[model samples]
Target: MNEEVGSLHERLARLEQLLTAAQRKPAEPAWRRPTSRESRWAVSAAVLGAVALQLLLPERLAFHPEWLLPALELLLLVLLFPGPRARKRRTTSLLRGGGLTLAGTVSVANGWSAVLLIRGLVRGSEGSDARTLLTAAAAIWLTNVIVFALWYWEWDRGGPVARAEGIADYPDFLFPQMQSRELTQADWEPAFADYLYVSFTNATAFSPTDTMPLSRWAKLLMGVQALISLLILALVVARSVNIFGG
Candidate 1:
């Protein structure tokens, strides 16, 4: 019975130590831990979806050479590679640049596609299948979501690799949970999913919700995202509905 009591006391003491350490540096979310799996999954899924969407789009809607964007994106993804461990200085710099470039390219491509889709709808569908047109709009909008998600993930306090290394000491966004101490644990670094959720909500609501953009760049990016999403939803979606005579 004495041994059991002693063990319980030790466990409580260790817990207290950990909590104290965490509180000492609550600002550094990545304080003492390595990058987690959520970051990896988020980026990998974005790349896969972007490539798939490129293939699924109509040849006319895709760039002049349908395979070019996908090939280039695949090459960039390969360049970053995102291996299991930290990379050398030069290599890490290249990977970071390549990742951001790929994300920007994805955003531009999807935005252009949305524009083209809107043009087609306005030009008159005539005998074009309404369902097919609607499908294209949906695909473009979804690609927009993925592209912006990547942007948020990449630009928020530098990229994932930077955050993992505890390099970026500042935040580009101020989430509600961050302001409330009781809301989340000390080790809660914003994951890719958190940014993805931010993008998703921004697209859906056409404005910032709980997460406030702190930097000028973040504000601009969120504004652009909201505008593009509004165009796709208001113009493309509404046009599709009109075509169906609803």
Candidate 2:
């Protein structure tokens, strides 16, 4: 009888252990840590888009000489592609710094334009031509999307290099695939395109939609982007409509 009791207890303990391990297994991340760095092609394209948008703006809205900002941005972009033989750590740091600087410069230029445009609108001196106003508004709106996408790509999870190295145990942005791991492949990782999509949705919806911001900085950034988008739509678009109607 005692021998039977011992065997029954041992079986119950073994069963409990299996249950615990099974529960833990499901809690583990479904995706694998990224082994390689993300590609820069998307980022490069986004920067180019921002540059083009800046060029498209009216000369009055653009900085003096109009080409200075884009020229400086292009110069910084060159730093992003260093010599192949450069040390890996140094290269990564340089690329991150250069990218941030380039994005910041674009952002500052766009912001200056936005301020000037708003000032002109308020003073009843700008956007007199509906077509010109609409065109300038579209350019600013698109540039806003591109620059925010760059910010999201560069800041998430301590930037792309850190993300590739698996330094951040948790993501700054909580993508839908991250939550619904079963829906995505094991090797899935967020890329520049993903960030761009997030930026686009946030700008359009004026709030986070599918992918949510998990960090304070992410929330703040999204909020600022939404505010800028709102200002452009409400002020510039409305002014254009008024001009056309009148």
Candidate 3:
């Protein structure tokens, strides 16, 4: 009887040790992060929805029409790239941050424009009054101009290029050389995070250079387009106030 009790105690100790080991085991890895493609699609959907709402909604219900254009432009930008399946969390976060910032700026500008219109209404200024409407419209246009100009300046100074060709693809040797390792999905998370941090923190000073400037004409066209947009925004606001009598 004494021997049997001792054996039973030993077995119990072994069982406890096994249980502790099992408890200490790490869990399976978390689901892989979404790819860049997924993020771009999400952004695109949000933008398209915003645009559709602006066009379809009543004036009283419209959030900001001025926002629709810039939002669309930003969406087009992200969609241009064929992003990898595995992206870094930081990268996606930064992209979302930038998008949100752009959206907020547009929304605020639109709100201010509406405020001007409302004030005009309270003062019994008719929307048909050219001077009153133009003044308000001009203010809105200027706001958009300033915003777009800054965006252009930042891009010209050193914004990321989606892709480079020929001499335009010259490498940067000034910074410490990162090892050219093929990035796996796991690797993408950290890399994307670092990419996002660098992109936002140094957006103004991150231009890449090569022997030849790619699409110099295209850059000029973009500037022209921004100017055209500002003009259109002004005209539309002026017309809209008059048409709606608000």
Task: Say which candidate scores most in TM-score.
Answer: 2
Stretches of model 2 off by over 4 angstroms after superposition: 6-12, 15-32, 82-87
Per-residue lDDT of model 3, residues 72-162, tens digit only: 5556446433433325656644654464465455445444554555555445453565564555455443443343333432232132222
Ranking by TM-score: 2, 1, 3
lDDT for each candidate structure:
0.76, 0.85, 0.42
Q: Which stretches of candidate 3 lie over 4 Å from their true place?
A: 18-39, 55-97, 105-246
Global Cα lDDT for candidate 1: 0.76
Model 2 clash pairs are none
Which candidate, 1 or 3, would have the higher lDDT against the true structure? 1
Decoy 1 TM-score against native: 0.79
Local lDDT at 87 for model 3: 50
> Could you give the C-alpha RMSD of every candidate to the true structure, in order shown?
8.4, 2.8, 17.7
- Candidate order (lDDT): 2, 1, 3
Q: Top lDDT: which candidate number?
A: 2
Q: Higher-lDDT candidate among 1 and 2?
A: 2
* Candidate 3, poorest ten consecutive residues by summed lDDT: 159-168
